[model samples]
Target: MLREIDVVISTNKDLLGLETLINQIKNQSGKFEVSIIIIHQYRRVENLPKFLVDNKILYKNLAEQNLSNAKNEGIKLSRSKIMTFIDDDVSISQDYFLSSWEFLNRNNCDLMFCRINKMNSNLPLSRNMKDNSKKINYFNSSCCLSSSMWINKKENENLYFDKNIGLGAKFGSGDETDFIFSSLSLKKKIYYNSKVSMYHPEEFIGLDNSKQIYSKFFSYGMGQGALYKKHYNKNKFLCIYLYFLSLIKSVLGIFLYLFFFKLKNVIKYFALFYGKIVGFNNYKNIQ
Candidate 1:
């Protein structure tokens, strides 16, 4: 009766998506026993699906609207040896759980970053997708996507996401990167594999709202900035190099987009650059 895996999902008002994801997990074919832990935030509990109420799933609600807080809460409640954190809006491949279980045990992995593709398409959700599996390092830690991560709780018992840098938090989006940085600092065995995959909706695929696009990219940039500051003391040289590297890339993107007359992309890069400056300066206040 031992639980082999705990799938932790933090959501806010995405009831339909939650139901779909949970059902998908239930339908997964595997020899492993998996438990579902849902950390719902920022709303009164609604009448959940009968299956959820009748099943042995663990569901909790929080008053605050913080992604990291919700995920941390899930971590505390999880009782399985392996834990997988996934977004509610995503769906897993047919063999997701079995593949992840096999990969973890076969490699003796402490933490794993899996591939994420756009729903109904072969295109990757994150730009960091790799063609092959390999051990993660400080230089390549950017490949750590939170949407489809698998962690061996027995190996990483103390692992937790940073509360200051995720959706609804001040910095607003580098929780996974910060987690990877901490793991690497601890000499944890982290790896990235394309075999274990999930499918998510493509971001801004058909969206026409300029303000929404700007806000999204800006928030992400702020999180990146705060992450650099948070770990600057641990490795000043790396932090400095990454900060400038990001700044340079953003600048180049702005100019390149401008030349191509892609106004939206120009705005996106500009917002990222500006947000980084603001987040870097505001880090002291938050700390």
Candidate 2:
């Protein structure tokens, strides 16, 4: 039987890691048939390994670096009824592929995002809301929704990730959540199942934290601003004002943390708001 679902992996600069990820997929036991498409964003893999070349996986070299661009290409090429986007460095248990299939059926949702588990203890976990409220919740970034999200392709073919945002693009992040937010605006059915999960081990090692923070948060802030401009058009003028106002908000956030004795968040709060300012200024850069 043909595979019922397609897994689109957006990755760059790591063929060995991609090899291991392929192994994990091969090792999975699932009731649903699966096919994969790897969107290599950069650095073409010359002399393909026999394991990957022999498999049913279709490989495409995308010279561009935008994560959203890779995702859009993958979605365009996907031939399954259902599709899920994942990052290359992420790993899932043997049951992950099958579980996502099950989740889509059980929830009967247009889009379903399970959970993303981080590998590091110090890093922090994405918000896990257990309530069954079923209300559309807005996400600050794609932090809560990992690449593990599952979706029905035929039902929402027009709903694609924003090309201007995400990694390798002008905007730092928010492609994942922006898709979710747009779906909500379109009044599409969305479900969140805390039980289903995807694991992404800590990869933020040997990096300069200060520089990383400055650039990443700035882009994220910009993404947020862009999201507002895209979805909340009425708020565009107000967003500009709020962008300037964030300096005050950032200072207040820092003081709030100091009051609560959570001193570490001082920089985090500052980073977040400062990034917002940077994003607000460069909102049109990606849009």
Model 1, 118-138: lDDT tens digits are 898778876778768889887
Model 1 clashing residue pairs (backbone): none
**Alpha-carbon error at 262 in model 2, in Å?**
7.9
Candidate 1 ranges beyond 4 A from true positions: 1-3, 155-157, 205-208
TM-score of each: 0.94, 0.82
- Give the alpha carbon lDDT tens digit for every residue of 122-215 in model 2: 2324544342324345532233464777777546346778888777766667677678877776777777766656677643433356666555
Clashes of each: 0, 1
Question: In order, what is each prediction's RMSD in angstroms?
Answer: 1.9, 3.8
Quality of model 2 by C-alpha lDDT: 0.68
